[model samples]
Target: MDASVIVAGAGPAGLMLAAELRIAGADVIVVERLPERTGESRGLGFTARTMEVFDQRGLLPRFGEVETSNVGHFGGLPVDFGVLEGAHQAAKTIPQSVTETILEQWAAELGADIRREHELLSLREDGEGVEIEVSTPEGRRTLRASYLVGCDGGRSTVRKAAGFDFPGTAATMEMYLADLRGVELEPRMIGETVPGGMVMVGPLPGGITRIIVCERGNPPQRRTEPPAFQEVADAWKRLTGIDISHAEPVWVSAFGDATRQVTEYRRGRVLLAGDAAHIHLPAGGQGMNTSIQDSVNLGWKLGAVVRGTAPETLLDTYHGERHPVGRRLLMNTRAQGLLFLSGEEMQPLREVFSELIRYEEVSRHLAAMVSGLEIHYDVGSGTHPLLGLRMPRLELSADGRRTSSTELLHRGRGVLLDLEDNAVLRRRAAGWTDRIEVVTAAPAGAAPGGPLEGTAAVLVRPDGHVAWAAPGSHHDLPTALERWFGPAR
Candidate 1:
């Protein structure tokens, strides 16, 4: 095989997956049609969960003084994202272009082969691997790999070529987004509705501002090129009575509320990630965040399979896990569109929502949903609270040394943390030492009676989710190891 995996597109998801695969000791190649990075950014920042994902790999310092906020909105309604304290706040200022550049650099530094100006033309999958044809700067060439993943956006060629069923709602309205340099506007971080429609304006770095306009009675339309700046300015005036045609346009584009998701994330040897697996209204800035999380989840699993450390069936978990998350993403974004973009008739629903959000429990629930902290997978049968949930951040002291749970995951290896340091438990896990890391430590400071209160030993996946917890075990350590890491070496 030319490489263990071939990743299509150089967007955030593709770059992130390539970096992860490299960390897990897999040969990866990333192909992108664009000759260079597009400075335009559709997503302004990432969610808190995505922040943790980056922090797991020690990639945050590279961004240099990230600006974050605990204050956010849910469908134009004010909501505080600080319900969970001591967690990373939502990054609010970094542009998507900067995110892509960082991930591309990270992936390249890890020895991932990235090919620019190389476009995937076609792909055919057999029982063993996938063969792909690409149009490159040199000429057309065929490349073979054990697996292929498409991160090429909503209109994914890999999803189409592989015959995956994309079933969901279609676009109904078109909205304009533009970044300007010569205009100074009031900050509408969420959005505001007028008699006609809604408009949003927020300041950015480098004396620039971003604006979004949704005009009433405008239907979604297809165009070969992006809408002109004047069109966006006109829509702004119609919605907010603001005619700032003098604002020098930096980037202009249009989008829709159409939502869609594939029935499955994997098909034989071909797989999908990012917008290829799911697309929805960019509500709560969840599109890019969800896409990045998807790549992180799939990266380690794919790497294990390619390196012959795990069974091929492990790849099936990617679909079983992320498909449901994608479905919920579509559901929540469609609900938000109704609340944020609908006509006056939605005022009553908005009022009801506003009233509901006043309760502390309601606020916390909504905040977790938008921040991606409430995700719980069904890893297996166990009553432990930490089971299938993200391993909460905790301080530990091992052999008089200090460390945190997040720091241990920087190397992209499964962690079997033994709080009691049982000799029998360590002996049982010795066979999988090559694939998993064993750490013996006790909680530091006043450890609360939370998920790890009574746990004696905990097993965490490379993606940061707790796969197994000890206290009461039905399957035992050996069984959990086999279920996640594969048969003992």
Candidate 2:
């Protein structure tokens, strides 16, 4: 095979998956249709869960210092994100273009072969592997790999070529997004519902102001190119009675509230991630963040299977875990669209939601949902509170040195954190040492009374979710080990 994996598209999901596959010691080749990066920043910043994912991978410092905020929104209502403990706040202003550049650089440094302007023409998956035909500058070329993953945005060619079943709602109305120069507008960070529809204004890094306008009764349009800046300005004027036609246009685009998800995330040797698997309204900037995470969840499992360390059934868990997340994504974004983009008919429901959000529990739930802090996988029936949840960051002291649970995961391998230095536990996991890291450490600082308080030991998956915890798990150490890391040697 030319490579173990072939990832289509160089967006956040593709780049991240390539990096992760390389980390798992699998050869990867990434193909992108664009010869160079488009400097367009469709997604701005990431959620708290994405921040933790990047931190655990040791990629946060590469982004320099990010601007984060505890303030967040659901639909158009406000929610305080501070209630979620032991995670970084959501980043607010880093552009998607910047994120792509960083991820591409990291993936390349990890030895991923990224070929630009090599558009995938077709694909065929045999029983053993997958073959893809591509159009490159030199000539048409065919590459074979053990697996192929599609991260090629909403209208994915691979999804079509593989015949995956995608069923959901279609675009009903259109909204405009524009970045402008030489314009000063009051910041409506969340959004404001006007007589016609909703309008939002926020400041960007380089003296640029970003505005979103969703005028009621605006029908969705079919277009191959971006809408004119005047169109956005006209909608803004109609919604807010403000004319900003004199402002210099940086870039303008249009989007819709079309929601969709594939019935399955995998089809034989071909699998899907990012927008290829799901699509939703760009509410609360969840699209790009969720896409990045989809790659994270799929990367290591596919790598392990390709490397012969794990059974192919491990791939089934990818669909089982992320498909539900995608379903909830579509549901929440569709609900947000109704709340934010609808006419006056939605005001009563909006008012009711506003009142509900006033309660701390309601706000916390909404905040966690939107920030991705509330996701919990079904690892098994375990009494531990954090059994299926993402492992909280815990400061640790091992071998007279300070380390962390987050630091141990930089290698993209499973971690068996032995909090009490259990020699028997280490012996039980000895056979899987090649596939996981066993660290014996004691809690430091405020970690004692927190989430890890009663846990004697914890088993964390490569994607940072807890697979098992001692003093509560129903399964023994080796059972959880074989379940996630394959049978021991």
Candidate 3:
């Protein structure tokens, strides 16, 4: 095989998956159609869950000082992200282009072979492996890998080539997004519903202002290229009665509220991630953030399977876990589109939603949903509150030094955290030491009534989700171990 994995598209998902596969000691090759980075900032920043994912991987410092905010939105309504408890706030201004550059560099440093201007032409999967034909700058070549993952945006060629069943609503209306210079506008950070439709203006770095205009009654158009800046300006004028035609246009694009999700995330040896698996309205900037999280969820499992550390059934959990998340994403984005993009007919429901959001519980629920803090996987039959949830950042004292649960995950391996230093627990997990790290540590000032209050030991998956917890889990240590890490040696 040329590589263990071949990832299509060098966007956030593909780069991140490549990096993760390399971390797990699997060979990876990433093919991107673009010759160079576009520098287009379609996605501004990542959600809080993505922030934690990056932090656990020790990739945050590479981004330099990131700007974070507790202020966010649900549809067009305001919500305080501070309502959710997390170690990091949602990063607000790091452009998607910057994110891609950082991830591409990191993946390359990890020895992932990234080929630019190489477009995938076709793919075939059989009992042995997957073979992909691609058009490269040199010539057409065929590459074979144990698995292939598609991260190639909404209109994914791999999705179609593999014949994955994608069924959902089609586009009904169009919206414009433009980045402009030589223009000053009040920051409508969330958005404002005008007489015609909704319009949003926010400041970007480098003296650029970003605007989104969704004019009611504008039909969705099929186009090969980006829309003109004048088209966006005209929509803005129609919505807000403002004429910014004189402003210098940086870039302009059009999008729609078409929602979709594949019936399954995996098809034999060909799996899907990011926009290839799902698509939704770009509400609350969830598109790119969710795509990144999808890669994080799939990366380690696929890597483990390819490396023979785990059975191939482990890959099935990827679809089982992320497909639900994608379904919910489509649901929420479509709901948001109805709330924010509809005509006056939606005002009553919007008013009702506004009133409902006044309650802290409602706001918290919406905030958690939008920020991706609400995700929890079904690890097993466990009563622990954090059993299926993400393992919260916990301070630890191991070998007379300060470390953290987050720090232990930097190696991209499963963690058997022995909080009470139980020798028997370590012995029980001994067989899987090669596949997981067993750390005996004492909690440093753990809160009395916190999520870890009664937990003696916890098993954390490589993706940061808690697979098992002591004092609550029904299954024994080795049972849970074999379930996630394959049969012990």
Candidate 4:
């Protein structure tokens, strides 16, 4: 086999998956159609949960001076995220190009083979494995792998070739996005509605301003060529009475509110993640964040399977877990589209939503939804309140040294955190020590009623979700271990 896994596209999801497979000691190859990085960024920031995910891998420092914000919005209505517990504000200004660069470098440092100018032409998945045909700069070639993953954006060649069902509502409206210089305008960070449509203008680094123009009554069009800058400037003038024709355009593109998701994330040896699995309106800046997370959730499980450390059934969990999240993603983005993009007909709904958002419960729920903190998988039947949830950040004292739950996960290994030093619990999980790390720790500087107050111990999956907890839980530790980390050695 050319590699244990072949990942199509070198965007954030594909590069992240490659790094994850390498972390699990599996050979991975990443193929990208682009010969070089575009340096143009459509996604401007990431959700709070993505920040924590990057922290778990010791990748925060790579970005160099990140700006986080406690303030955010849902459908252009203000909703503070500070109300949620353990929520670090979302990263405000990191560009998608920078994110891709970081992931590509990290994956390369981890020994992932990344090939540029390699376009996937065809793929065939049989009973044994998947074979792919690719067109390189020199010529066409065939590559084999145990599995193939598509991260090639909304129009996925792998998803199409593998016959994955992508069903959803088509685009009803289209908008223009441009990043350019030589123009200065009042900041419309949360977007502003005008007579005929809406417009948003925000400043980026290097004197460039990002503008989004959404002219109402403009139908969605399937165009092979990008919209000209003059068209965008004309729309801006018609909508908001602003003339941006003098601005020098750096990058220009168009998008639509076309919502869709794959019926299945995997079909035999071929799988999907990121935009390949889901696509929706770029509301609340959740598209790229969700795509990045899809890779994280699938990476460890696929790595385990390829390394022969876990059963193939574990792979099924990727679909079982993420497909629902993708469904929710589509739902939320569609709701936001109605709230933010529709005409005056949606004003009442927006008013009701705004009033409801004033309530702390409503604010917390919406904050968690957009920030991705509300994601909880059905790991098992347990009422520990922490089960199937991403493990909260905690300060721990281990061997007279201070560490954090996030630090323990830097190695990308499952963690059995024994908070009370239970010998029985430690012994119960000893058989899986080779695959899981056992860290005896206790709360350090924790308040009386903190999130982990009643927890005696917790088994955290490699992806940072709680697999099992000891307090007020009936599932045995050994059973939980066997279910997640594979059978005991």
Clashes by residue pair, model 2: none
TM-score, each model?
A: 0.98, 0.98, 0.99, 0.98
Error of 2 at 430 (Å): 0.7
Per-residue C-alpha lDDT of model 4 across residues 1-489, encoded as one tens digit per residue: 999999999998999999999998899989998899998798888899999999898999999999988898888899989998777779987889999999999999999999999999999888878999999999999999999999999999999999999999999888999998998899995546777777888888889899988888889988988898898989989987778899999999999989999999988889999999999999889988988899999999998888887898898999999999999999998888777777888899989998999999999999999999999998888789889999988899999999999999999999999999889988888899988999999999999988788889999998899999987567788888888878898
Q: How high is the lDDT of residue 117 in model 4?
A: 93
lDDT on C-alpha atoms for all candidate structures: 0.90, 0.92, 0.91, 0.90
RMSD of 2: 1.1
Looking at model 3, report the run of 10 residues with the lowest lDDT sum.
Answer: 188-197
What are the candidates' C-alpha RMSDs? Answer: 1.0, 1.1, 1.0, 1.0
Candidate 1 C-alpha error for residue 427, in Å: 0.6
Residue-wise C-alpha lDDT for candidate 3, range 239-267, written one tens digit per residue = 78889999998888899989999999998
- The digit string of per-residue lDDT tens for model 2 on 432-485 reads 999999999888885336888878999999999999999899999999999999
**Model 4 residue 432 distance off true place after TM-score fit, in angstroms:** 1.1
Top candidate when judged by lDDT against the true structure: 2
Following a full C-alpha superposition, what root-mean-square deviation does model 1 have from the true structure?
1.0
| TM-score quality measure for candidate 3 | 0.99
Candidate 1 clashing pairs, residues 3+ apart or interchain? none
Clash pairs, candidate 3, are: none
